[model samples]
Each structure stands twice: as C-alpha cells, then as structure tokens.
Target chain A: MSHTLVEINNLSRFYGTLQAVKDVSFTIRQGEVLGFLGPNGAGKTTTMQIISGNLAPSGGSVTIANHDLLEDPRAAKNQIGYLPESPPLYRELTVNEYLDYCAALNNVPRAKRLSARENTKERCGLHDAGKRLIGNLSKGFQQRVGIAQAIIHLPPVVILDEPTVGLDPIQIREIRALIRELGRDHGVILSTHILPEVQTTCDRVQIINKGELVLNESIEGLEHHMKSASLTVAFHQSPDLQFLENLPGVKSVHPEKDGRLRVFHETEQNPTDAILRMAVNKNWGLYEIRPGRLSLEQIFVELTSDAALENAEALATTTTTDSGL
Target chain B: MILTIGIREFKSLFLSPLAWSILAVVQVILGFLFLARLEVFQLYQPQLMAMDGAPGLTEIVLPDLLGNAAVILLLVVPLMTMRLVSEERRNRTLALLFSAPLSMTEIVLGKYLGIILFLLVLLLMIALMPLSLLAGASLDLGLMASGFFGLALLLAGFAAVGLFMSTLTQYTTVAAISTFGALLLFWILDWSGQGTAGGNWLAYLSLFNHYKPFLEGIFNSADAAYHVLLIITFLVLSIRRLDADRLGG
Candidate 1:
C-alpha cells in the first residue's frame, strides 16, 4: 500500500469559454515517473501546472502528500518543484551563482546550501560548468541548469513540462538518462508530445485528448494497445463467415472481398490457439499470417490527427508558445 | 530580515551603472549650485556678520543645496525604482525571488531601502559642498539638517510609488515608462489648478505637497504621517500582487 504523493480530483481549467483541462483526475503514487502525453492544447501543461500549484484550477482540488492545495498550499508547494517549458535562466549569472540563488530562494539553510549546491551540481551534470555564465552555455547545458534549479531543494515531486522541446538527439538521450536517474529518487511528472519519450522513459503513461483522459494506464498497457496482435489470413478457397466467426474467442472476423479474413482477438485469448483450430476445420491454404506493429509515431499520429485530437493546434501553435522557450 | 534585504538591494543599486551615473550627475549639479549659492552668501554675510554675531554656517547655503537636491531626486528617483521588481520579472528572475523563503514584504522593503541608501550616498557626496561652504561662510545647522530630512522623506515616498509600479509588470520598459509618467504627473500636474483651484483638499493629497514641509526643514508630524501612510499603502499593494500566485489562500 503506497501513499499517494499527488492526488488531483476533477480538476478543470478554462480560458474563458475554452476548456483546457476538462475534469482531469489522477493520483500519482510515490516514486512513480508518470509521463503526461498529449498533443498541444490537450491540457498536459495545464494539468502539470495545477499539480505544481502554479495555476489555479477552475474546479476540483489537488492534495499533495495529504496537504490540500487550497488550504495548506505552502506545505504542498514546499514538496513539489516546477520547471516551465522555458528553463528560466538568468543570462548574466554563472551556472553556480544562479543555482546558489535558487538554493537560497528555495530555503536551503545557510549551513546546507553548500552541500545542496554540490549535490545538485553533481546530479545535473553541472559540476564542470558551474562557473560558466548561463548566456554563454549551450542549449543542453542551459536546460541542465534549469533542472538543477528545480530540484536543488530536494523536492519530492518535480514537474517538467516539455523538458526536451529543443534538443538534439544526443542531448535528448542524455536528458532522458538524467530524468530516469532522478526518477529513482523523486516522483517525476514529464510532459511531452514525443511518443517514443513515453515508451522509453515513463513507467506509466496517460494520454489525454481534447482535455479528457482517453487512456490512463501503465507503459505495458500502452505497448499492448499499440501492438496489433491478431493476423490477417488470406485463403486460396473461401470460408463461410459463420464458421470462422463461430471460432472460440474470435472477437470478430471481417471477410475481405479478396477472400481474406481479418481477425480480432480478445487480449486474453491467444490468436495462435484459434488459428490452429481454423486450419484443421477449414482445410484451406493459409497464404500469410504476418505480425503488425504500430510505431510510436503512428500511434501518436492516430491519437492526435484531425479526427482524433479535435484540436490540431500542435502544428501551428506550439511554435507560438516556444518564443520564450 | 528587512535589513538583510536592504543591504542586498543597496549592493545591487551601487553595482549597477545607472545608480553610479545618477549619483555622479546629481553630485556635480549640487556642487555647482552650492558654488553660486556661496556667492550670494558672500554678498550678504558682511551685513549679517556685522549685525549681532552672524548666524553660523548651516544657514546661508542650505536652501540652494537642498533645492538642487530636490530637483535631482525628482529626476532620478523614478529611474532608480523603475527596475526593481520589473527587471526581476522581465528576466524571469522574479520567479526565483517568488519561490524564495523571504516574503514579498521583505523583497519590496529591501529594494526600497536600497534606493534610499543610494540616495543617501549621493547626499553624502553633496554634503562635501556645504563642508567647503563652512570654510568660508555661515549657515544654520538646524536648517541644513531639516533640509536633508525633508529630502529623505520626499524620496522615500517616490521610491515607494516606484516600487509599486515595478510589481505591476514583467517588462522593464513598461515599468520605467509608467513610473516616470506617474511621477512626472505628480510633480507637475498641480499647476493644472486641480489641487489648488476648488481642490485644495486634493492638492494636500499629492506626495510632493506633503513633502514640501520637509524641504523647508520643518519636521511637521502631519507631513511625516502622510509619507508613512503613502509608503505603507504601496507596500501593501505590492504584497497583495505577489500573493496572487500562491496556491488557494
């Protein structure tokens, strides 16, 4: 029995008439690295903001570690850290000075600020670049500095919104590794539209569409959802629809005009068992039974396409939000 | 805690080129004003010294010295205060300050005190003028001391207003422009006869009018109370603006 670290209940946000987060509710268990997935404007950032106590929810409530957000915000906020889409770096100061300032701001006592600074520097890969000014650092290093500021106070929940929006491949991999490392100790909520990010880094995935939680499950469940298991069998001779449909555990069999049959299997029922049964009964030549895999890109496209997302601003508008980013 | 914030703000004000520039320019102008004022004193001191033991040094030079400082403060105090919270917010450093352990009151007070400290340093630099005047002329000590007090109170009120404006936005340009406009209006709009013609009561409400008593080296309790009240009003407004982001209550 794990204690819930963050519990959001019926949280909804509206920008006047537009509903950003439509009744979003979820509980994040302690030490869980939950990935928040959605196309732009699917309420990922809004939900993240609510969890971090940065944005006020239009309805419902958030309780962090049993401290109600509306009642005991200070205590709740003290436990969570938030890094916005932009790293929020001070260009004039060196990485060390900025982090030290953040440390003092986050209430690291005078006696402990040095040790906290040392710890964050090591954890965030800033040990070698502390003296370098943030303006002079590369994008990746600047991002690392952002992470350092967010986690310098040893917060239990670190909310990162689009942490890898503008990074190269190698930088993305390094940041992923860093996120995984942080997840070992801190409960991290990472928001990104990049699907592979979830498959690789998240222990659990929640996909929201049109401000509604369309899918809320573990990473394996996501893999299963995207994994098209049942095969399509094209036969040389025709088989009766009833005979194939009567097959045990065959959820549905759609007969193609070309004498082929597409089968749907209940996730619990193995297609292999029913396929063997079909072969013995039909005595028809089985031309091919190929496996199908839905790439993360395909699933993302399918999940966020015009018919799917109902709001396809990810293409034209996320760019608008990135000016400051 | 307020003192700590004040010291940090004081350091930041001095470290910035703007503060240094304002200090130098104001001091030079005061220095020149003091020289001309000494000429007038030289013309009149003979008669005064001849009559019943001349009034000591603080008298003759204090008005011109204080008058020049008043003009200088009206020009520079707005610039000194415009960037306080506005720049922090513009550079995104305000978030760091917001999340820090210190409350908004401390930040505002610290930054306000820092501006006051900067003004004091410039005053000290200007004090050199009167010290030189003392070598050759006579002026009243009480009058000079009162003039400095009046100037401090006047600038303190202006700094408070500027600090309030800084909290209004994340754009330094907007903050600076609006603060300048607001102070300028306060300093000159009384000529419109709004405060004086059928609005004598409203005229009394203006910060400059309240501060005029201090400039004359008169420590009126009503004037002191007016400045203190205005300062508290702006500080409270700043604190409320900061509380907008806190979770719930």
Candidate 2:
C-alpha cells in the first residue's frame, strides 16, 4: 500500500512570462488510479508532458520507479506509457503495423515484440481492426489504438491525457471501464475535466484550477468531507425561518418548494434529533426527514468556482502593483 | 531502434501514391534525357572519332545525362523528404516520439537513412541506363562509379536539408518549398561567384562545385569530404531542432 511509483516534486513550467504550472507536487502509488481534473489551460497537459519526458520543466524534479526523469530519461521513460491528448498515430500504417512499431520503439525485446503487440491490441479492443488503416478507423477505434500503443510494452506507469474526449457516451463508458481495468495492475494518471469520470473511474481525485492544485482527496473523502452536512425535511405547515435557524446545532436553514426546509449543521453534529424534538413541541407537523447527499457536479462547481475567485483576487493585486497603485 | 523507425518509414513511404507518382515521373524524365543524349552522341560519333582528344561514350554522354539526373534529384528529393517530419508534426504524431524512450539522434538518423534507402533504389534505376552500353562499347567503369558516388552523396545532402527544414514547421508544402529554396541557393552561389575575389569562398560552399570534380572523372578526396561535411552539418542541425522542441515545449 505504501509503494510509490511516481513522485513529482515542485514541478514548474513557464511559457515565456506566463507560468503554466507552479510548484506542483504529488505522488502516485502502485495500483492507484489518480484522476487529474482541471479546467482548460490549467497546466494539465504541461504537467503530463513533463512527467512523460515530452517537455522540460522550468523547475523541480520527477522520479519514476527511482529513475530521475531529467538525469536518466531513457530508463524513466521506459517505465511510463503515455497517451497524449491528440492520440499521436501514423495514419498511413495499419493498426497492427503501428502497434508493432510502438512496441519496438519502447524497446520490447525482438522475441516478445509480437506477443506484446497482440496482447495490447486485445486489451484495447483492437483485435478486430488489426489490418485496417488507422485513418480509416472510426474516432473511437483510433482512440483505442492510441491506448493500445501506449501499453504495448506493458509499462508500469500509464499516463493518459483526455483519453475520452470526443468519445460517444457509450464509448466513454467502455473506455472508463477499460481504464478501471488498467488501474488494477498499473499506477494510472488520467486527466479530464469531466466530474463523473473521476467519480466512476478514479479512486482518488486531484483538481487543478488556474495552474494550482485546489483539491486532492480520495473519492470517498471528497464525498464525505466536502459534502455539506444537511437534512431535507417536509412539513404540513412551513416553519418560521428564524425558529429553525435558532435550533440546537442548526447553523442555517433554507426553505425549499412544497413546504420543505433544508437544515445545515457542523460535519460532526446531526441537527435532525433536535429539529424533531422542536417540531413536536411546536406542533410543526413534520412529515419527513432525510439526509441529503451532495452530487459530484455540485462539489466540482463549488471547488472550481472558489479557486477561480481566489485567482481573480490574486490577479487584481498583481495588476495593482504593476499600475503603481 | 533506428532500423525499426527506418523500416516503418520506408514501408509507409510506399504505402502512399505520392511516392509512386514521384518514382514514375523521375523515370520518364530520365529516360527521355538519356535518349536525347544518346542521339546527340551518335550524331557526333564520326566527327569525334576523326578528331584528336575526342571524348568517349562515358566522357561525352554519361556526364550530360548524369548532370540532368542530379538536377531532377534536386526536385524529387525534397518532395520525398518533406513529409518525413513535417507531416508527423501536422498529424500530431511527433508526440509519440517525444514520449518514447528513444533519443532524438535515433529518430533523426532513422528517418534520414530511410529516405537514403529510397534514393538508393532511384539511383540504381538510373545507373542501369549507363551500364547497358557495356555490351556494344568499351565504357569507363571508373568514371561511371565516381559519378554515381557523387550523385549519392549529393542526394544524401539534399535529404538532410529537407529533413531539417521539415522540423521548422508543421506545413509540408512550406517544408518542400524551403528545401528547394535552400538547395537553389547552394546551386546558384557557385555560378554567381565566378571571377570574384571575396566570392571565391561562396563557390566552395556550393553543391555543384564539389560535384563538378566527380562528374569530370576525378575522385578528389577534398570534394568527397565536402559532401560528407555538408550532410553531417544539416543532420546535426536537425537533431538539435528536435531537441529544442522537446525541451522548450
């Protein structure tokens, strides 16, 4: 449980004067599926590029299975299988030829290259499209080939950048299932802006906004910690807002449609018992009391919006300094 | 790793119609030029035989035909080499190379050798035209070998330049035109530098000036070295360009 496969320390990347990634640090353990969520242009691709040895970082270091990326790129890269955002493929070659080339490029031994190619093709569901030209394949199959090539050598660490973009809903579901399967054997880092993707496929989630890591937690932790502790109750007659707000352990109360009120409380405290006692004493005619679960979309919106507001405030202060205000 | 990339590149080249079209076009043009040179040589055969210091078939006909072939190669090599890197970049397939464990040198050299192999096939086809005269006439094998050797080096240099230009942009057409433009600069600089003091060095930089010795049946080591140096310089520049892309972006 404690074996770390990838350790990224204080990674930074600057494009001219604009900082793309700033001092980002994280570690991924073996057999852990880490969902890297970020808004557009939030340095997700840049960070993935640096870890895969495609781009150089402006600062910091990355180690893969104890191999330093900058000092020994070949050994470090050999441990990583990367699928970039666009699915880098040679359109002229057939699926089999392309995978064979990829296996060779990743330095699979000559004797095992054929078996490795066949196994990867089977894993990515490309067994039927072996002889088909890559350009002629549908977008979904092409994306599969992209994944097939990445895992041709059976690398220990697999990095996929926006693997499900432009995929049909069904295809997205299938790919998500495939990613989940991959997670069982290899440490996987998947980047996406889709909230449900992380919920369904990832064991842990890390969200980046404005080039900064704003949220990092297990899926269970995100559901339990960031979720507001609340109960939705319906009454035969509406309760006074001040009466419910002043209830023991009740921090705030929001009235909903159909004579219902949502009562909030601290994470460690449940106000339902106190609300029930108060309702009976006042003859509030309460009919139902049910705990509410925060939807993943709500959590995503709240976290990203909060990060955006902080970024805006930081930008304003920098602009003020530049203007000599 | 280099052979793997080279084999893939070579196979992919034949997989497209553009490579076949180029091969057909080169063959037709070279055949017509060879026939024209042969006719001219036959017409002048009697007068040349009667005159002192008259040039033979190898000296008179082969050089003219080969010079024309060299000019045609200037056009054909760029078209062949333009897509080597530029198309990969345009199609966004270069990212595959970046993430792989292979070094930049391996990729560059592998692609270069792949194009060189294609050009070798083209050279073999052209050489058969000159070698066919062996049955009827006594030909200078030495002169023909030197000419073929020079053309091979010259084409290798052209491919190097094309490969380098391809790395500068994602547009294949732009790569093709720039490679043609760069070769033209090297070709014309020799002619333009005629009889000038400071311009003498410019002639040395020209591809034709180094090739002139081989065309004249003189195997000058200095001239051979020139072509080798030119090929090495452009290939090194290509490797450096790829490295910058990996490091900077």
Candidate 3:
C-alpha cells in the first residue's frame, strides 16, 4: 500500500511566457487507476506530457518507482508506457511490424520482441488485426493498435491521454474495458472529459482546472465530498418547496421555473427511499425520483467555468489598477 | 536499436506506391542521361580523345558520370527525407518516438543510416556501368570508387539538412521543396562564382565544393572532414531542437 508508483512534487510547465501547468503535486500508489479529469486546454495533457517525459517540466520533480525524472529521465522513462491523445502510429506498416518496431525502440531486447508483441496484441485485442496496415483500419481498430503499441514493453505505469476520443459507443466500451484490465496490473493514469468514464472505470479522480488541481479524491469519496446532492422527484402539481425542505434528507428545494423542482439535500443522504415514502404519505401523485450524481461533464463545467469567471474578475481588477494610475 | 529505427524508416519508404514511381522516374532519367553522355563522347571523340590531346576515360567519362549522379542524388534525397520528422509531426507520431527509450542521437543516426542503406541499393542497380567498364577496358576502379564515395558524402550532408528541415514543419511538401531549394542553392553557389563573379565565398561555403576534390580522385582528408562536420552540425542542431521541445523548458 505504501508503494509510491509515481511521486510528483510541485510540478509545473511554462510555454514561453505563459504558464500551461502550475504547482500540481500528487502521488499515485501501486495498482491504483488514477483518472486525470479536466476540460479542454486545462493542463491535463501538459501534466501528462511532463510525467511521460515527452515534455519536460519547468519546475519541480516527478519520480517513478523512486527514480527522479529530471536526474535520470532514461531510467524514469523506461518505467512508463504512454498512449498520447492521438496514438502515435506508423500508418504504412502492419500492426505486427509497428509493434515490433515499438518493442525495439522501447528496449524490449531483440529475442523477446515476438513474445512482447503478441502479449501487447492479445491484451489490446489487436491479435487478429496484427497483419493489417494501421492506416487502413477503422478508427476503432486504429485506437486498439495505438493502445497495443503503448503497452508493448509491459511498463509498470501506463499513461493514456483521452484513450476513448473519437470512438463510437461500442469502441468506447471496448477501450474502457481494455483500460480497466490494464489498470488491474499496471498503474494507469488516464485523462478524459467523459465524466461517467471516471465514475465507472477509475479508482481515483484528479480534476485540474485552469492549470491548478481543484479536486483530487477517490471515486468512492467524490459523492461524499460535495456539499449538496441533487434528487429528482415527481409529485402531483409539482410538489411545493416547504414539503421537500421539511424532509430529513433535504437541505433546500430550488424550484425550477419549468414547473419541475430540483431538490438539493445533504451529501450523506440517499433521500430516494425517504422522498418516495413522504410523497406516498402525502398522496401528491408521485411520478419519479432519483439521487443526483454529477455527470463528469457537469462537474468539469462547474469547476472550469467557475475558475474562468474568477480569472475574468481578476483581470478586470488588474485592468482597473493599471487604468487608475 | 538504432539499426532497428533505421530499418523501420527504410521499410516505410517501400510501403508507399509513390516510392516505386519515384524509383522508376529516377532510373529513366539516369538511363536517358547515360545514353546522351555516350552520344556526346561519340560525336567529340576525334577532338576529345586525340592521340596528341587524348582525354583519359577517368578525365572525361568518370567526371561526366559523377556530375550526372550528383544531380540525381539531389532530387532523390528530398523524396526520402520528406517524411522523416515532418510526417511524424503531422500525424503526431513524434510523441511515440520521443517517449520511447531511445535517445535523439539514436533516432537521428538510425534515420540517416536507413536512407543511406536505401541509396546503396539504388547504387547497386547502377553498379553494372562501372563493372562493364572494368571488363571491357583497362579502368581505375579506385578512381570510380572515389566518385561513389563522394556521392555518399554529399548524400549524408544533404540528408542531415533535409532531416533537420523536416522538423521545422508538419507539411511533407514544404519540407521536400525546402530541402530541394536549399540543395539547389548549394549546387549553384559552387559553380556560379567560377562562371560569373562576386560569389567565390559562396562557392567556398557550398557543399559541392567539398565534394569535388573526391570526384577528381584526390582522396583529400579536408573534403571528408568537411562533410563530417556539416552532418554533425545539422544533426546536433536537430537534437538540440528536440531537446528544447522535451526538456529545455
């Protein structure tokens, strides 16, 4: 349990004068599936890039298996297998040829290349597609090939940047399954804006907003952390606020202008069974009820939009400061 | 591992339909030029190979052959280099190469060696021309070999330039055209001064100037050193550019 697979301390990256990632630190333990959650251009990719050694950090250090990344990137890097946003692929080569090349570049040893390629192919479900050219494959098969190449060397840590991007629903499920299986044995850090992806697949979730880590917790604890829980309820004539507020679970009832009421409760309360019983007792003609779970999308917008609003205000204040002088 | 990368790049070239078309085009051009050079010799043989002012085969035929080969290599090298880094950038495949365990030096050297190995195969197809000369007449194989060696050096330097330029953009057409233009400028810089004026310094800077001594069968170390220096300079610059991308931050 104490095995720190990845230790990041105050890491940051700056592109010229602009800061891309800033003051982010986290430790991932062995066998943990860490879901890196962020919206577009929120430094999730930049952080992942730095951790994977494709981009260097402007500040701090990342240690993989106790090896410092800055001091010994080769040794640190050898412990990592990264699948970036667009799977880096050789379009002209067959899958077997590409994986064999990946194995060699990854230092898998000459004699073991075949076995390594087979292992990655089997794990990534690319065994049948091994002989096909990557460019000729459909987007789904191409994604599988990308994952196959990343894990060819069997590194302890696998970093995937939006592994499910541009895939159909079936492809998304297949890739998520692949990710889950990979996380079982390898410490996997994946970034995606797909919130349900985080809920269903990840063991831990780290949400970065506007270059700063806004939320870092396990999926199990995420629901508990929110101050409010949304519960959907249906009643005859759309039950009034006093009825919901009086319930033991509910904190407030913010009635929507659309005649439907959105009842918010304390995070710890389930409110489903209780709200149902209350509705029946009152004979308000209850129609529906559900406990609120923040879809990954809503959470991302809430976090980033909030941050952006704050940033806008800060910009205004600075502008005023300059103009007043 | 370096050889492995080289082999992968070499194989990638073969996978394309255009590579075959380019090969056929180059062969046709070379074959046509060979016939033209032979015809010119036949027409001017009386004055050129006179008993009183006889032009040795080495002096006339070998220089002419090497000059034509120099032009062919220039056109061919750009085609090979077009995808080296630019395509990787375009397809976002550079991330894979960068994240791999190999160093920048290994990747760069591997690609150069791959292109060189491919050029050698093309050289083999033309091997018969010199070999036929050896069987039919008394010829200096060493002198002819020097010409091949010079061709290889020029290719090495130009390939490095092409590879470095490839990293500047993601468009293969831009990379190819830029490399061709850069090499054309080098070729012109070498001869423009001797024909006109005000370009002697440019000629000294031209890559072709470094190559000419070897073509003349001089076996000069300075020429070899110049080629080596240019290759190293460009390669180092490319590596440093990637270094900035990955770590200079």
Top TM-score hit = 2
TM-scores for all candidates: the values are 0.85, 0.95, 0.87
In model 2, pairs of residues that clash are: none
Whichever of 2 and 3 has more lDDT, that candidate is 2
| Segments of candidate 2 deviating more than 4 angstroms | A226-228, A256-259, A307-325, B197-199
Candidate 2, residues B1-249, lDDT tens digits: the string is 898888888888999998889888999999999988899999999999899988888998788988999899898888999999999989889889888998899999999989988999899999988888887888999999999999998999999999999999999999999999999899888877877876778777889988878989999999999889988999999999999997776
Interface RMSD of 3: 1.7
CAPRI accuracy category, model 2: high
Descending-TM-score candidate ranking: 2, 3, 1
Better by DockQ, candidate 3 or 1: 3
Q: What DockQ would you assign to candidate 3? A: 0.57
What fraction of the true Cα-Cα contacts (under 8 Å, chains A to B) does candidate 1 also have? 0.25
Which candidate wins on DockQ? 2
Task: Write candidate 1's Cα lDDT for B150-217 as tens digits.
Answer: 77777777788888888888776777778777776776645555645565655667666766666567
In order of listing, the candidates' clash counts read 9, 0, 1
Worst 10 residues of 1 chain A by lDDT: A307-316
For model 2, the local distance difference test gives: 0.90
Per-residue lDDT of model 1, residues A1-325, tens digit only? 2567888899988877888889888988766789988887788877876776666788999988888877776677777877877777777677877777677666678899889998989988789998887889998888889888889999888889899988899989988998998888788899997878988898888888789887788888777876765657777667676776776667788876776777776667657666766876778766766544667677666766756444456644777788758
How good is model 3 by TM-score?
Answer: 0.87
Q: How many backbone clashes does candidate 1 have?
A: 9
In angstroms, the error of model 1 at B118 is 3.8
Judging by DockQ, tell me the better candidate of 2 and 3: 2
